[model samples]
Target: MVDRPRKPSALATTPGLPPQPQVAFSADNSSVTATLPTGESVSVLLYGATVVSWKDKKGEEKLWLSEAARLDGSRPVRGGIPLVFPVFGTAPDHAQTKALPQHGFARSSRWEFLGKSTSESTPTPTTPAFAATATSAAGAVAAAAADMSVKLDFGLSSSGLSEDARAKWPYAFNAIYSVTLNTDSLTTNLVVTNDDDKSWECQVLMHTYLRVDDITTTTISGLQNATYTDKTTSPISSSTQSSPLLTISSETDRVYTPAGDSPASVPIVVSSDNKPKFTILRDNLSNVVVWNPWVEKAQGMADFEPKDGYKQMLCVEPGAVGTWQVLEPGDAFEGAQTIVLGGKTE
Candidate 1:
């Protein structure tokens, strides 16, 4: 079982209404933050519904975000969870993806705030013609100390997309993203329904950036012995990880694809000095993309900023990248990843 910090419960001594999530605007009012009672909270932007920050009960960030990350809606946010959909990092058979944005329009395109699961917000996240049923949603977010979970859904569809985006990939679809926050872990669930007659293949990923004291000092487990395509190499060679503790000392980019008979829930352990800080459990996501732009590459990118910002963060993404997830007509696909905080033995 997962181990979380033993927090004192106040409900037993002081009786009151269960603290509802304060779904309010940030001080700047440009973004919204869901402040959970458990002291763990997540901030999101209405622009792309991009999750910008997720903090634990101690108010420490589990995710790594660039100091220069933009929130003006000009481009895809540089950090947090930049939703990658329809296509992932320019694949082979996706003809339309080449012409459109880098990781498909989902991240770049604006999404409508369909509101909360309760009546306070809108009923659903779709347009008048395509709102889906509640089955698209999973369990709600659990309080920092409470038993029940809190859930909020965001709607994005072909109809709600911009003209330029719709012209690029014409497929009727409803994408309902329900973000449920638990006491120890925050779950991101993506439910995609193909409303069109033709089937389509796509890739989706939560390009998650994790924060660390130093990138080079951390070792990532759970991927050892798995086959991976080394993108850092010229010809892109594939190899099996021999080391039980995979350490990153230089510029690294690799995609790990497990065997068909591998365990369904792969636990990727992130640790410092042999003590785990947190564990990322990926469900239905067989691939893990590990990347850190070390020196020269970090200087060239405008988003990385400060020239040496790569030392503080790492991207250990879980998604369907090696192969594609196909959705037939009227079919729905659900994929999720849960990040459970470790003992914090720092």
Candidate 2:
């Protein structure tokens, strides 16, 4: 058995606020930072998270996660990894969506970060050294603190669940999300537990937005021969049988399933015409979703890119589709995905 390091000391908790357990870890050059309150964190490449945010470097009050990746620009500050549960995207029947707003209420909600001392079991592997590095970096933010990496946990509260959420889907469920940044990559893990007596069914996903210098010039692989569904058209089409590999042209929206049962370990390499490659490795996920609002649609989104901003980024999500996952009373379900930076291909 791999020797797990001792759990760090108790996190300093703020009175009247949810337990904000912040921890830190460090390796050599890279560091990670996590806040248990929001499960929000940052990985300092010593360079930048991914792309350099000119706005952030200038000391503007810009949201770090906003410029980092996965921050739902349109939603509240509880950003970074917006947890989409009970459903992803829109419901098959548009009428059924009236009660819910946007992407089913997890993003804007605040979560409680169960402190570091608490023991939790998860399907994914735990890297204590990496967690340490992350937390240590966070400490550096304070003038008197040391450099380290940290891992934080957040739990969903009844109050945190939005009114819109209750109107659309009424069920008791608890979700715990953790974000950990290591020297080489960022890992996000989500666990949902059903508290109600009846089994519940719903689609689940992690909407990840990646920052790039130029989307038009970036070439993304891993979907070659993989199957996908085009959301633009009501009737889903298979990219595998017809349009196998996907390269961004104008506007694109497609959901893909791995070619086989093997986890999608292959890097979804994204290379710009002249820049480095950003590799996305998805694991334990059933589907991959690629989307871009394009010209007219981009304008429709409250916080999406301007008509031309579509050329800056792409959303390649890892999710479960078509059928909704059913969780029985007291049962919990978990899934994980990873995004690694640097290392471009020729």
Candidate 3:
């Protein structure tokens, strides 16, 4: 009898590409770890392709995880960098009134592991081509990337999604999420290709939660000359803040946008006692969300796990979340951010 062959699935192994010694699959075969030769490393879960953790050469965790975060694929894990796509906050318009559970569904969906690479090539995105716009910045990431970094790619397509999720989203598209880890930094790139026949509008964000020593004493800068929407206020106040640093105290939830009145690269710095300063930089992504559940809000959260867990975590998310974008059929959107530890800590 002749053996029949299996058609290619998204996660199928690429021919001639063997696993690298620096990369390892989890014991239970759940997650993958990519470690740099210099000892910096990152681990990503297939579910949501969420970056679960990043450790420096010293083996200190830079990203935060909830004391109560469920890692068994039950729900969106509460920490790390969650990929938020299709929409950012609540449905922004009438077409998406059906969007429930806030922040859209991309974070809860599973992604296909496209495998790891030192480098990979992809057709440049036509929609929201940010690299062209970032030319003015002399040292932008597009200039070049170091060859020593570890790269991993994950994919998700409407064809592989559940009918229930498709019925709501209904847009035919393919997304590739690339994660790069170097000795000093980690970069996450989301490239989405629109496979539909018509145009559609959507929002994307990298909701990154950074672990700090203390939320109360942490100082955040690079957003001083920016405009922010105070989501914690009853009326949702909008104003420009000129101060260089915004300190967190109470239940803080603020969305800040570069006040340049045009698209511009922004850098956000989060620093606290005994914690290495983190510098988050991104272009094309315009808005930054700063949040800490605080005491009362932390106690009320069902997923926070540790009732007082808010004290150790602060979220400083960077993405194109403040404005909606349109993607023409066959086009794509690319946005990336890099976080690096800099300077001495207390």
Candidate 4:
């Protein structure tokens, strides 16, 4: 997969590398401080808009988004990025599902960084990189002289809602959430707009949790035949599968559906068995979620790690799961996902 070339400002250009650091925010902007070119330095916090912590490059705390519920205790507050929607897990008034907690509150609520632009002209380089393309329909498109990509836009206001999201599901919808990072890939675009006129049936997901090293020597390569649904027992078990390149071994959740448009390139290869370097690439997302909890739900979780952190990490995610996407009124729906880190290019 050897491509490499587009580096004009992937937030400070990085050809032979070594510049990187220039994603500031926080002057009451709430937080978003990337600075990686290996100097590592992520810091995304927006008070419940979620992503409360992400310290690496010698700081530690890789990933884990909330733990401490050995069935009912509490500590919640683990990693970054966690925004499932309308309803992601559990619902049937289990006491209003503990009054709306446990993965629904938009990763904790509070996200507003709608500012950043570049590109009105300038685009003509392509062979390995340097594209641009993003006229209007959102905005911003730059690439070259060091690399730069913008499409930033986020919303869900009322000072970022939370009265348990207006008493569990009251509608008045508006969610943009668009992001684009360069130097290979990081694209994310989610548009959910329904200004309440009628029709609204949510069930969306984006629980992206990636930070690997082991996960028992990772290997995810696009779902071969795709057609799953096995959210852990009880009247839920569809088939027409194809994903047995095995190696997981325990508590694994599943949900896939993609057999058209020839879209499939999931690759998750981690191989820390000594030498295989790193690999990530999740192009446009076609759906591939393979989880692990092992040990009877890791003994009920309180931060999960027993079993040697379940061999480290692995969570393929790019979703729609359990079906529920019905927007009317003002109607709007968009989805795109991509993440392409380095290593592996034979």
Candidate 5:
């Protein structure tokens, strides 16, 4: 027997690149986790394409998730960034969305994870010409590549909706949600496309729950002169934000809209003791919703655990809830918000 002829295996002939250290998927593919070279990471659940956790490079969690939040596909996740779409809250009496539930179906429907890609902050070409560069230059290029950020995409369409949801809002539509994890920031963008023949009206909101050491010590800025709809009242009264920084002391629920011709791209900052904690900047989102169940409301909700959980979290949501953004047939609307983590604390 000729034992001298062992063929080279495929693995031996072609070596495979190591697995990406920046992106990972759950065992059941129900979630994804993306990490940066700098040690920061973001985890997203496919249930609602909701961001479950976002941590700084030092492993400090920034997003708040309720302890009683349902993650078994039973109900929409209560915290983190649960998306609200097609309708803001309590479907208006309008004919289009009169029969829908509060906050629409985006957060309750299961989304398909569309995989991920990465973008280098400072792209370094690895072409043959660049490969021939000096060792020092090559080292610098490798260093820049290490700063690449990971972006995870999720998709949901009318065809993918449950029969109950599809029957309620019988319109052909598609939505894509992207979450990008950077070293010091997390950016989430949503693009909704109307595939129906007729136009439709809808609203979008990014319900972001930011974790804080103490709600009493936290204050939200950048809405001083903005007009807000106080949803805490029965009739939903309107008022102008008098103070430069607003502190939460009650069951707060308000939708802050741009005042007059104020730019819609202003940065909403959350701070404690005058030190910035999180800075939220939005694009194409003109309204911001600040919410907290406080003591009474918190104890009333079943999903809100610890009863006093409201004292450690604040919902600084960036949204377009003031008015409906009408989308024509075959058209698309995109809105995004970037949350930059503030300076690292001791």
Candidate 6:
């Protein structure tokens, strides 16, 4: 059971205003949920700081979770947006990440819940993309706070790691992940700091799994003409995307990178029957991965739940995985991605 704060603060009950959004923790303190006054809500588990659920105002889920996903801290949650850090995938040839598990330890490690805050803002952030804006903007500038939003912060540091995980990657580092929920969108931001005396190299990815009515009716737009590495191909092939919209019919795993004058922050749309369903906008994250395990691959994964679940979910991940980022001691790297539901057409 979750412990919800039912007592409304005096200001929240003010005569003409709507009740402020509320954030609550589970009775066991293993997870937390934030609910907007309008009825949208999001929940995050401490293990890996994985977002387990995100519901719209009408209670429709936007993110998918595998039925077989292990939520007991035995492994990483297999859905929603799993944070991949230090390494994107298996790197047997790299000296720095060779010993670390695929996608590093961030996803499987437990994170400290730093707390929650609420604010009011417009749909678009000031910096546009890849930046942290005011949380509790309602408190700082009460007069300007109109539309309500909520944010939850989670933290992980080297000192909090288990003995075996610490031994594999000895660098001291700190990671902060923020999940911000608005009326019509969800935004996630990650900041990594090299806390060790020596510099280190790493990759970060927001591996987002979006729920859809049917995969066959879905098409992704915005990568046309951009170059992508087709990981599903033997020897891995790279080519420009010739189609304005891409669909998944078979096993697909391609990482798209911007080429020529293509901007990295361009809006990527996932549509169903030519109508927009989700719009992804990213900043400082140069790569986008479009993947679907399809039939064979989906059946082979132990935690993928029903073998046919692939038809109901798609992984449209925004990441900084095309190249490694080297951070100097005391330096930090930040990246963000925002997913808007029922996006507007161009």
lDDT of 4 by residue, 168-204 (tens): 7667777767555444344556777888767766655
Better of 1 and 4 by TM-score: 1
The residue pairs found clashing in candidate 1 are: 38-144, 64-209, 141-149, 141-150, 142-149
My TM-score estimates for the predictions, one after another, are 0.83, 0.66, 0.82, 0.29, 0.88, 0.88
- What is the C-alpha local distance difference test score of candidate 1? 0.75
- Residues 106-169 of candidate 5: C-alpha lDDT, one tens digit per residue: 9988999888898764433655434543455545454554556888999999999999998989
- How displaced is residue 317 in candidate 3, in Å? 0.5
| lDDT (Cα atoms) of all candidates against the true structure | 0.75, 0.56, 0.79, 0.55, 0.86, 0.87
Candidate 5: clashing residue pairs, number: 0
lDDT of 1 by residue, 78-168 (tens): 8788888988887545664666677888888777766764211223345331243334322121211344345667889989998988887
Model 2 ranges with Cα > 4 A deviation: 1-80, 92-98, 115-148, 234-236, 241-245, 263-266, 274-276, 343-346
Hey, what RMSD does candidate 5 come out at?
A: 5.2
Candidate 6 off by > 4 Å? 1-12, 121-146, 260-262
Q: For all the candidates, what are their Cα RMSDs to the real structure? A: 11.7, 11.6, 9.8, 20.0, 5.2, 6.3
Tell me how far the alpha carbon of residue 267 in candidate 1 is from the true structure, in angstroms, after superposition.
Answer: 0.6
Ranking by lDDT: 6, 5, 3, 1, 2, 4
**What is the number of backbone collisions in each predicted candidate, taken in the order shown?**
5, 25, 0, 14, 0, 0
Worst 10 residues of 1 by lDDT: 136-145
Q: Candidate 3: which pairs clash?
A: none
Give the range where candidate 3 is weakest over 10 consecutive residues by summed lDDT.
138-147
Strongest candidate by lDDT: 6
Stretches of candidate 3 off by over 4 Å are 1-21, 119-147, 261-263, 273-276, 343-346
> What is the C-alpha lDDT profile of model 6 across 1-346, one tens digit per residue?
7776896656445543446788898998888999987789999989999999999989999998999999888998989888998899988887888899989999999999998888865434553321333554443333223357889999999999888888988999999999999888899999999999998899999999999889999999989888999999899998999999899899999999855454567889999988899999888998999989999999999999888999999999999999999999999999999999878522
